[model samples]
Target: MTVQTWTFVIVGLTFALYILIAIWAKAASTKDFYVAGGGVSPLANGMATAADWMSAASFISMAGLISFMGYDGAVYLMGWTGGYVLLALLLAPYLRKFGKFTVPDFIGDRYYSNIARTVAVICAIIVSFTYVAGQMRGVGVVFARFLEVPVETGVYIGMIMVLFYATLGGMKGITYTQVAQYCILIFAFMVPAFFISFQLTGNMLPQLGFGGKVADGTYLLDKLDGLHRELGFAAYTEGSKSMIDVFAITLALMVGTAGLPHVIVRFFTVKKVSDARKSAGWALLFIAILYTTAPAIATFARTNLIQTVSEQPYASVPEWFSNWEETGLIVFEDKNDDGVIQYVGNQEKNELTIDRDIMVLANPEIANLPGWIIALVAAGGLAAALSTAAGLLLVISASISHDLIKKQIKPDISEKGELLWARIGSVLAVVVAGYFGINPPGFVAAVVALAFGLAAASFFPAIILGIFDKRMNKEGAVAGMVVGILLMLFYMMKFKLGLFGGGTKEEWWFGISPEGFGSIAMLINFIISFGISRFYPAPPEDVQEMVESIRYPRGAGAATHH
Candidate 1:
């Protein structure tokens, strides 16, 4: 079968499976909508959490970034994986014990202030939207290639599909669907790796294959480094980023992972605090399977791309090249009117332009893998993007409907009314998400990294202080979050988004890239929070007691609304 035909079959089947699961697990009450009725087993929640955590950033873009960025890309690997550990160990159990459906719910009740809750709601909406933009873009990228549709049309399709399941079954549907997604994505991710690994180094395990000898009896990394040097690029094994930037980016991603609202809300779906902890462990294990394989895939893809394209005649290039070229991701200009390709690193001599996002998607084709394998990757990419998009959309809707409308503006609203409002909010969010998808600010991993920075800057400080500091008051938490998020927005706009007339890399604040500036902003938030807290009265006595109560171990109990 042709790759497109296989894609239609696999992708169509997976989509049908997701829709069926959503129908089977449809939510009938507020609890079901919010936290899947808080009865999910640890194993199921763990698989669902892994699917939610991976995102398009992990399944599609992480390895692609690594393939192009080489050594510097390790920052993403370290930051994201390290961040998950931080979240599981430091935040998940306590937040589960607090028994809240959303981050704002915890912030509001713990701080004993509706105003604080409102601020948290705004932060949640902003962060979730920024993250979902990357997911939507991932969806568009896959469809544009496999389905041969315009990226705009792909975004619209993704928006409609996500809206159907996300709004209809809410978290109840998303959780079960994610479990199935995890299986498909993991299978899709690994099969190609295994095939390519054996083809290159006679090893079925990709993790070891990249380190093993290639056909010429040289280590894969050593050969890549040789290729890079020959092409006037830096050695593949050496990093170009400064130490401070790497450290800052890693810290930012770690704290940001802990602060992400959609990921945190998964912990609330479990039955008890202990269950949350158990699920966290299970999730980390499941996540490691792909994380370990990514570097190998990146290495293999980079080597294959260079070997297959560089110096090859335009007419003689593989069929995969022409297919991707039609999508405009691969451009061959035939510089100097020579028949041979010039894929050198130097801009002046380079004749081939490749988008880094295409490396993973294009890998199986480049290596001449079977058609079914290529199609399976397309389905995996969609599964990864849709699963996380659903999760983020749910957070956006819950922030508005549960945190803002029910808790503040219309405290007397009935459960059914709130559910209706939540669905309305989800629909609105999908429209906005689709817009960002069509007008994406950057590539998938880059956009996602910025969202992590935003999460780190805005939510990390407030949540940590709210949980651990008994004296933390609403005035300080609210002020800190506003300042932190604004500071992050300013930096991202000026540097990342190229606002404020756009500055050069040399002009970055204290030599930090916008992606790493979150660490500085988070530090300042901690400072501002502490500095202002001394002037205000401590939290109310009962609030402080609630904080203390959350700190201790307790019997396993269902998540609560109080």
Candidate 2:
């Protein structure tokens, strides 16, 4: 079959499967909608959590970023992986033991104040919306190339499909669908790696293949380094970012992972505190299958890209080049009126402009891989984006319906009314998310990193203190979240979005980029929270006792709704 036919078939089957699961596991109650009735087993939850955690950023964009950024991309790998460990070990069990529906529920109950819950809900919405925008953008990119549609049209399509499943089934549906998505995406990601690995180095393991020798007995990394030097670019193995920036970005990502409301909510779906821990372990194993392969895939994609296109004749470019060119992801300008393509590092001399987001998607075509394998990649990219988008949309809807409306505005609202409101919230959230998708702020990974910064700045400190410190009161948590999120927003807008009289890179505060500034904001939050809490009286006696109770593992029951 042709690539388009294969894409349609695979994508159609996967979509049908997801819709079937959504119908089969449709959420009937507020508890089911929110936490899948809190009866999910560890293994299923593990697969679901891994799928939810690995969004478009991981599937379509992470390897692409690593291909272009070279060694500097390690921050993302280290930060995100380390952050998951921090969340699973330090936060998940405790939160599950607390038996709350959402992060806002924990804060509200722990602090004994609706005000704290409101603040947490706002932060959750902001963070989840920012993250979901990246997922939608990923969907648009995949559809633009494989489905041969405009990016806006693609976003609309993705929004409709997600809206159908998410509003209909909620967490219950999303969880089971993600389990299937994990299998598809992981298989899709690895098949190409195996093929490319053996074709390049006579080895099936991509990890070993990248370090192995080619047919001419030249080391793969050495050849890539030689290519970089010949093209006036830095060596692929050398780092360009400063040590402090790398450290800050890594730390920000780590803590941000812990604070991400969507990922944290995954633990709540498990049966008990121990089950949450077990799912975390299972999730780490499932997640590692992809994370470990990414660097190898990055190397393979980068090497193939440079060898295939650099200084090649524009007229003789492969079918894949023209295919992507029609999508506007690959641009050839013939700047010097020469027939040759210049893909150099210097912007002025580079005649070929390639979008980084296209590297992973285009890798198979560049290497002359089979059509079916290439089409499978498109399906994988969609699975990754849709899975995460569903999870984030759930977080946004739950924040509005469960936290803002039911808990605060109308405490007397019936269960059916709350479920209706939750579905309504899902519709509104998807509309806003689609707008951001159609008009994304940046490329996939960059937009996702900014969302992580926001999460790190706002939620990490409050959640940590709420659990570890008995004296951490509502006033302090509320103040810290407000200031932290505001500071992050200011830095992100001024630097990343170029909004506040947009300054140049040279004007960065303390020489930190916007992606890494979350660490500084998080630290400030810790300080402000500590400082303000001292002025107020300690938390109520029962609140303190509850805080201490969650620290232990024994006697913890199933996750509760309210």
Candidate 3:
């Protein structure tokens, strides 16, 4: 069969599997829609969570970022995964034991203040929406390349598919479909990594191959580092970022991962607190399958790309070069009119635009791999983006319909009416996200970082304090959230948009980039909240007892009190 034929067959089979799973696991009640009826097996929940958490950023952008950033990208790898340890150990089980439908629901009731809940809902909506927009853009890019559709058309197709399954099965359907997606995406990711690893280093294991000697009898990493330095670039294994910036970015990503609502909600699907813990361990294991392979792919792709393009005449480059160049992903400039593509990195002499997002998507092409592998990657990218987009849309709709519309605006709405409104909210959100994907205001990865910063600064402190500290009052939680969010906004505007004034990172108030500002904002939040709570009144005695009950696993089955 032709490669395009195989592409059609593979994508068709995957979609069919997703639809079957959705039909088999369709939700029957509001509870099932919200939390998969709270009966999912830990292993299945773990797989679903892995798929939901590993979005387009992980599948497409992460390896690309690493390929370009070299050692500095390790922060993303270590920080994102390390945060899960915090979530599993400190947050997930307690939140599951609390037996709440949403993160905001737990915070509001725990602190005994509707205002606190409203702030949390707003923060959740902002984080989820910003994150989902990038996922939609990933879907568009994948479809535009492999499926031969317009980017906007690709987003519409993704939106429709998500609506069909998400509205039909809710979390129940999403969980099963995500399990299938995780399988497809992981297989697609690893197959290319293995092939490329063996081709480059004659080693079967990608992780070891990354550090092993190349076919030319030189250590791969050492060769890469030498070439980078010779070309006026930073070494592949070392970075130039300040230590404080590195520490802050790592901390921000760690805390942000713990604060994400979709990831936290996965714990609610498991049956018990112990199961939640087990599921988190399993989720990390599944995630590691991708996380560890990504760096190897980055190394292999970078080496292959540089070797292929370094001396090739610009006009003689392959069709793939022209194809990607048309999309503005890879551009070339024939400085000195030599008509040869100079791939060297000269800090002062070279001016070329290479979008890091192209690293993974163009890897197979750069390596001259079979067309089937390239097509499979396109499907995998779409799967990653769509799964994450669906999860984020669910969170956004729940914030509006469950928290704002039902709880605050109209408490007497019927169950059916509430669900209808939720579906409406989902559709509206998808439309807005689709528009932004086509007309993004910034880079995909950078936009996602802003979302993480916002979530970390606003929700992480509130949720952590609400669960673990009995002395925390509504006043402290509200004040902390306000202070954290405002501080983060100030940092982002100063660096990201230059709204505060004409300034750059070199002139940052404390030499802190916006990307690393979340950790400081989170610290400020913790200090302010804890300090004020000490001076003011504590949570009521009953609330304190409730907090104690949530820490234990035995009483989780008790009927939830409104």
Steric collisions counted per model: 0, 0, 0
Candidate closest to the true structure, highest lDDT: 2
For residue 131, model 3's alpha carbon misses the true position, in angstroms, by 1.0
The alpha-carbon lDDT assigned to residue 416 of candidate 2 equals 98
Q: Model 1 over residues 85-161: C-alpha lDDT tens digits?
A: 99998899889988889999988998799988998899899989899999999999899999999888889999999
Clashes of 3: 0
User: lDDT ranking from best to worst?
Assistant: 2, 1, 3
Lowest lDDT 10-residue stretch of candidate 3: 553-562
Better of 2 and 3 by lDDT: 2
lDDT of each: 0.93, 0.93, 0.84
Better of 1 and 3 by lDDT: 1
- Candidate 2 off by > 4 Å: 556-562
Residue 521 shift from truth in candidate 3, angstroms = 0.7
lDDT of 2 by residue, 44-76 (tens): 999999999999999999999999889999899
lDDT score for candidate 1 against the true structure: 0.93
Residue 277 in candidate 2, Cα distance off native in Å: 0.5
* Residue 287 lDDT, candidate 1, scale 0-100: 97
- Measured over all alpha carbons after superposition, the RMSD of each candidate to the real structure, in angstroms, is 1.0, 1.1, 1.8
